[model samples]
Target: MTEAFIPIFYFSGTGNTWWVGNQIAEELQERGCQAQPISIEQVTDDEAHELIEKAAMVGIGYPIYGSDAPLIMQAFIENLPAVTGQKPMFIYVTQAAWSGDGAYFMRKLIEAKGYQIRWAVHFNMPNNINADLGWIITMILKLFQAKLPHAAERAAKLAQHIVDNQPWIMGKSSFLSFGWTQRFFFRKGFDSSHKNIWSVDAEKCTSCGRCVRLCPVDNITLVDGLPQFGDQCNICLRCYNYCPELAILAYKRPYNPQMFGTQPYQGPVSEFKPEMLIEKK
Candidate 1:
């Protein structure tokens, strides 16, 4: 019999989801299962289908945005081919705080595609959005550090459950689902108008084009050596958070890098780089 292997398709803006997904993958590997964490942005449609078709189980991970999965992840799920024979799948989400029904939202989407969900979990990490806050950021970082081991242990247990075929479904509730529905509609409306919300500070911008390279959706481009925003932005905050010069500004509150001199969160992994998410040709 062939050994079970799982592929975790994940999207991370500032690295929290990527870190968590890798931890889970590592734990799965330690338990004698083959697993790998693949960035959703770097995956091609044909590659995704092949991975899903050959895997014993599938996993999806992403950061929770506005109590739901990011737009890119939602599109990935929507584009997935429905599985035959009810393939086993699991979901995990990373968030700074309460995610409401974020995992449940993904569960419903995947279940609709004929995958039997075996696990759904969330991990609270440092707040990437509010990285500019002074003492608050420090406090959150401390909390994240304290919770790191617990989160990793939980991930290990999740792997063990998968290896043992034990089901552990989380973040599902009628009450939370109701709230999620309202938030989802509001988020969709806000996202539609968010294209023009980002502006580049030409003075601070170094014309390095890092934002253009880091953008998952190709929503940014260089015009006259300056980055320009487009209508397809999923608002992953990658360009904003990963900008070396802190030049990218969002119209939303808490995104004022100029006024706040916001410190960008470089993700949990110290060696992480923006170029790592870029697909290599």
Candidate 2:
């Protein structure tokens, strides 16, 4: 019999979701399933449709931001082609703390498109925000590393459930559903802005165009060798965390670079390269 083919589409801001997706894929493969982890940023709409059409099951992974999936992942889910047979699907999310109904929110969205959500899991990962916290952040990252084995074991269990056709659902409480409102307000505050709140320190910027290349939504562009930001920012923090020189400046409001300083994170894995997320044309 042919092995089941599963494609996991995931979005990672600073590598937490990417690492989890890879772990799940590896576990699934070890269980005699053909699993591939595809970056949401890299997959074209037609390519996504083709993969979903042929896959035995679909997986979605992302990091929780403000108790919700990132804007990029939400858009990807919204644009997905509706399936007729209610294809089985699973979801996983990585977060630093409680995600409330993050997984459930995504389940409802996918269900609206005629997908049956078979399983949903959440993993707590190292906090990517508040990088400027210095030593406190270091301790948190150390804790994440210490718990790595347990996380991997959980991933294996998730894979095993898939292999056995077991149903596991999480974050389904009615009380937790308040996270949907939180997500709505969060998106309205950050995503509805017509003004750009991203900038670069010209002196620190090397004109390397890394930010332009790494932005998942193509909201960054090079203008005369300097990176310029558009109003379509998803606020994923990929460019800010991956910037080599800490040149990228993000403000809570327009024209306020001093509001938050840049402190680039090196990602969860030592060998992670920002360019790896870029789609090869």
Give the TM-score of each candidate.
0.87, 0.86
* Cα misplacement distance, residue 221 of candidate 1 (Å): 1.2
Output the lDDT of residue 89, model 2. 92
User: Residue 230: error of model 2 in Å?
Assistant: 1.0
Q: What does the lDDT read for residue 52 in candidate 2?
A: 93
lDDT of the structure predicted as candidate 2 = 0.79
Runs of candidate 1 with Cα error greater than 4 angstroms are: 131-146, 178-182, 185-189, 252-262
User: Model 1 over residues 1-281: C-alpha lDDT tens digits?
Assistant: 12678989998888888888899999888888889899977888789999999998999998876787777888889998889899998899887776667776756667788899888887877667643445665565446432567778879988888888888867677666664765667687776767667887788889998889888888999999999888888777788888878788766323454633456667776887767766653
lDDT of 2 by residue, 174-267 (tens): 8877877878877777766524567788888899988888888888999988898887776677777777777776553222224233345556
Native-referenced Cα lDDT, model 1: 0.78
